[model samples]
Target: MGRHDFFSKYAPRPGRLRFAVSRVAVLALVIIVLGWIAISILIAPPPSNEPLATVPLESVPTSSQSAKGSASPSGPRVTVHVVGAVKKPGVYELPEGSRITDAVKSAGGLAEDAHPELVNLAAKLIDGQQIILPGDSTQSQNPNLPAPSNNAKISINTADAQTLQELPGIGPALAERIIDFRTENGPFSSVEELDAVSGIGPAMLEKLADLVVP
Candidate 1:
């Protein structure tokens, strides 16, 4: 008999029906196992996100503002006169912590004949100080005068008109006025007393401190 005929013939029998039922059950179990495997593959967790890039909001630092708000003290500033043998011999305004070298640089550097050994370049400057550069021949003649003394100090109380002229912003006329004011008034109680004189104000006095005598 043909296979189709054989299967049809056996399809209605109790034993054949039992065998067909068992085969159907086996197919259903296999289908269920395959669906469960597909579901497990689809639902697996994705890879971690640890290596992504992040950006910052601030700008990089530069030389201009290396240290902001770290300014030096803001009290009175000293002014000094650097005359003779300097490139730009004039009055220079300096802070309290300035050195003789700083004043020389501000005066446009020393002249060719300026004896570098004469003055202590590292010496700290004071208010109302006068720094005179000697001539080449004079420096050679007087080696002692080159370096100021350890006790080298300015006497503001007794400075003459010529010495007072060495102050910054004080020309011959202003120098004369300073002397006259001191003569009329008693010895200055404070350096600020110079502002009491006519034509000499806070601005001018501030610039005169490093180079002034009395």
Candidate 2:
């Protein structure tokens, strides 16, 4: 082969060079578009949920409300008539587990003439129980009072507030004051010390002197 013919056969033409350059340009453009899409997916911000995440705070209960919620219900009650030598003789309604003494207390405790020894105070009381005092059921000169008897005197130092009310002209208020005085000043040494209690006049003291003992 001649030198010029060999050179023409081996070297590329302008048309083929133009076609290869066009293909390379199209491939580079596709690569750049794919790289941009990948970068956008990796670095884009997360979806917002501001309204969904927000919530209102709940209100807390107060101490009084909590106490009401935790409280247990009450039990059944009973009614009884306390007639006789009580301070306030009448009918009263009380809860279950009440005793005869409790019914007596509801009627303002026993009166001056009430004989505590005659009734069983520790006994349980039922509905509609009639609590008649020692001498109350009978007809007499002082039927509402205690039955007369030659009995031992009441002990002043050991007597409770209700027992103290048995003294002549003594009521619940005076009995409580006497108990308070006794607690503050110690036990009474003599009957004359009755005068030391508030609301106790000389006449009252003289009346109590013969009734109580230390």
Candidate 3:
């Protein structure tokens, strides 16, 4: 075949040749559009079914934090010495509002010969307080005579004239004067108040300091 001979022999008209060329161009454009759509579908990301993340607005306290916040405060405590006719006598620690009876119980209760009626068991305990339980020996003794031992200090506010005379330098006249002073002025608040009495001087007070308590 020679150049341009095949188209001239098959079509024979210029109008037919132009119509075929337009039909071929339209089919090529349609194929290019379909290929472009397939390429976009393959490269694009897929749709997701998972939910988005979010933060809470308020926080809740943990177990330790809740326990700390709800905890109650404890009451105060006091330490005292329990002596004399209890089953076991020693220093003990107790709550602030504890009474003498409670201290006795803490010391294993009163001994067989202890005279519980002589002591006010309901009295409230204080820090550094000393409790002395009188026994059968003490109950049998006469109140006018001095105690066998000087280790126990006499209470000036509660002691009678005979008991007051048990202290050093205190005679019948001085004991009467101490009783008169306390009777006239009311109970002594402190041992130092004994100086207010006419006969008791600084030297006498110094000597009685360790032997008596107000």
Question: Comparing 1 and 3 by lDDT, which wins?
Answer: 3
lDDT of 2 at 140: 73
Cα RMSD, each candidate: 12.5, 13.2, 12.1
TM-score of each: 0.33, 0.37, 0.37
Off by over 4 Å in 3: 1-69, 137-214
Model 1 misplaced regions, further than 4 Å:
1-75, 137-214
Clashes of each: 10, 1, 0
lDDT of 2 by residue, 5-65 (tens): 9999989999999999999999999999999999999999988867676587887889999
lDDT of each: 0.65, 0.73, 0.75
Q: Which of candidates 1 and 3 is the stronger one according to TM-score?
A: 3
Model 1 C-alpha lDDT per residue in residues 1-214, reported as the tens digit of each score:
8999999876688887899999999999999999999999999998897897778769766666766645565877887777656788778888887877888899888888765443445655656666665447545665423332233334344454555565566678876676667556644544667888888888887776544322
Q: Output the worst ten-in-a-row residue range by lDDT, candidate 3.
A: 141-150
lDDT of 3 by residue, 57-123 (tens): 7868899999998998768987878766789999999988888889999999998877665445765
- Lowest lDDT 10-residue stretch of candidate 1: 144-153
For the record, the alpha-carbon RMSD of candidate 3 to the native fold, in angstroms, is 12.1
- Candidate 3, overall lDDT? 0.75
Ranking of all candidate structures by their lDDT, best first:
3, 2, 1
Best by lDDT: 3
